[model samples]
Target: MPHRTYLTTPIYYASGAPHIGHAYTTILADALARFARQSGDDVLFLTGTDEHGPKIEEEAARRGVEPIELCDEMAARFRSAWERLDIGFDRFIRTTEDEHKAVVRAFVQRLHDRGHLYAGSYEGWYCVHEERYWTEKDLGPDNTCPDCGRPVRRIEEENWFFRMSTFQDALVAHIRDHPDWIVPEVRRNEVLGFLEKPLGDLSISRPRSRVQWGIPLPFDDDHVIYVWVDALVNYLTASGAVDPSLGPEAPGFEDPTGSWWPADLHIMGKDILTTHAVYWPTLLMGAGVPLPRHLLAHGWWVVGETKMSKSLGNVIDPLQLQEQYGTDAVRWYLLREMPTGSDASYTPERFLVRYEELANVLGNLAQRALSMIVRYRDGVVPEGDAGGLDDAVSTTLDAVAAALGDYRLHAALAAAMDLAREANGYVEAREPWAQAKDPARAGDLDDTLATLARVLGVLAALFHPVCPERSAELARRLGLSGVQTLQEARTDAPGGRTVERGDPLFPRVDV
Candidate 1:
């Protein structure tokens, strides 16, 4: 059986529209999934909208519409944006789905039965925007929510709480035991620092009177499960683990054989590190469900020295960029510009720089190689020894694999780009055009064209995950139905196949 890799992006909040930040995360996940599939791994990639929360309710009221209506509109927008960007997610889950609600109720009921939940009276600062409670120390100096720096409200009411504190020590031990459980050393250190403080019990429910737009607790309809809890269960809900209709004694929770539970990777922004690293693992432990293997917390996309935010009007619309520069260009700029685990600043100058790199390097090489093949070899790949680029291709493939193993997306892209540059240099050194003009060097010309064709084959695979559309076009030009894996391309003899030279894969863009 092929190895299975299950990956997920934190479902985007439906209270707002999709932005470049959302695109960045989904694009990264999509690239990883595509690469995994190409490498003979079964991949399950999940992405969707977080449709239930106090923020949604308030926004609906402000717009004079039902909450579900708002969620419907925003969810559609997200779906459309992702489709436009060519994101190939396996499942686009929504929190409002009947199946998801069922799983949430079942999971919560198990926690209650396991004595991890209790009824309690709570009073603290609550941020409507973030839908989270903040203690005195967690608030800003001006008594605002620390996370969003927004004014918070004080609400004292009866609610149910999770015994999150009980698992604090265990969580710490797990983090210490597996130093790589949380990625990007900085984010891991951040979680550990947060844990230095005593872990407090989490308020897991809100009274219906206070919040009417969340999943009702299975134990009590008067109180609904908090939005974060409802949202986090989405991964499990999509994993096909623990069918709610089968009751709590089912084997699905203990054995995830037929399901994709215990997800291999959970990808999200650094802002939500605590929820995934701390809240989620403890919740799984409470319900006797296996925890995900890894959590990758990536940095945000900042603009003007501030994180991109709708309120600040700094959000870049990825759809617009795709419209102007093509889907692959947008995806390339994002993956190439941002180093994994670190924040990246967006600027038109930088965008054009990355775009030019593609057009001048990969695109130019593709154009030159195929055009030369057509001019000298009648649109057919020449029969020659392609061993000239063998060592370089092997080295590049190894570097790409190693970079991807570490989840360094930018590094992987750099390695592929380096191979393109190397191939271009090879074309310069070999001088296929000069050889074609010399009757005495006919065999040398064939070797050069054949070596270039082989390198193009390898490139089509290396670039496919990041820029599927253009890579497919390049493969079609090379007379292949689609892109092949690096392994397949390494042994592929490109000689009898007919080639068609065409326009540049990435056309020059005027900034």
Candidate 2:
């Protein structure tokens, strides 16, 4: 059986429209999933919207419609944007689904029965935007939400409380023993710092009078589940582990069971470190489920040193950008410009710069090499000695695979780009243009075209995860249909096969 890799993107909030930040996270998850699949792993990728919350309810009331109506419209927008980007997620989970509600109730009831939950009355600083309670000490100097820096309201209510404090020490030790559990050395340390403070019991529900737009606690229908708790269970709920009905049918075998439990990776923005790193693990331990193997916290995108927001009138729409440039071009920009676990600046100028390299470097190489094959070798991929190109291509592939192994996306892209640059240099050195001058030098020309084809093959396979459509086109152009693996890349071009060239994969764009 292939190694199983289950991963998830932090579900986008349904209260807002999809933006470039959401697009970036989804694309990153998609690329990682694609890489795992091409590396011969059984991969399950999940992404979706968090549709229940007081915010969604308020927004609906203002619009004179049901909260579900608002959620449906916003969820459709996200689905459309992801489809436009060609995100091949295995499952797109929405919290409003009936199966999801069942899973939430069942999971929470288990926690209640396990003595991890109890009834309580509490007064605290609550951030509506974050759906979290902040202690007086947890608040910023301006008395705002520490996470989002938004104002908080003081609220007193009777609700169910989770015994998150009980497992604090265990979580800290687990993280220390397995430092890689939380990625990006910086984020790991931040979580440790947060743990230095005593852990507090979590308020785990909202009275119906206070907020009613969530799953009802299984034991008590008068209170709705806390938004964070409801949202966190989704990771397990969407898998076939906790609630079979909630999970979609896994493509291959029947009854997936817990094969995908203890997820391989949970990809989220750095802002949610406490939720995934602390609350999630403690909740899992309380319910007797193993912790996810890894938590990767990535950075945010800012527009010219300012965070993009609607009130600020500066949000970047992902669909508009994709429409302006091809989907792969936009995907390339996201992968190329940002290092994993680092903030990336989003600007039209920076986008065009990265976009140029795709059209000029990779695009130019493919067009020149294949056009030569057709002109000099009758469009047949010849198996002339790959020459030094084999070592060059192989080395780059190793570098790319290594970088991907560590989740260094920008580095992986750089490794692939280096191979493209070297191939271009090899073309210049061989002067394939001048080599074709002699009709008698046909064998020598075949050897040159052969090496170029092999190099292009490796590039297409290596880049397949990042830019699927263009990479697939290039793979077919090299006479290797669906050639998406490293092993397949090596054995491509069995010496004398015809291939076709399409219009330019990325037409050069004017900045």
Q: Tell me the lDDT of model 1 at 266.
A: 97
Which 10 residues in a row give candidate 1 its minimum summed lDDT? 246-255
| Clashing residue pairs, backbone N/CA/C < 3 A, model 1 | none
Give each model's whole-structure lDDT: 0.92, 0.85
CA error at residue 376 for candidate 2, angstroms = 1.4
Give the per-residue lDDT digits (tens) of candidate 2, residues 350-420: 99988888888999899998898888778997778765488887788788878877788899999898889
Candidate 2 versus truth, CA RMSD in Å, comes to 3.2
Considering only N, C-alpha and C atoms within 3 Å, which residue pairs clash in candidate 2? none
Q: How does candidate 2 score on lDDT?
A: 0.85
lDDT of 2 at 456: 83
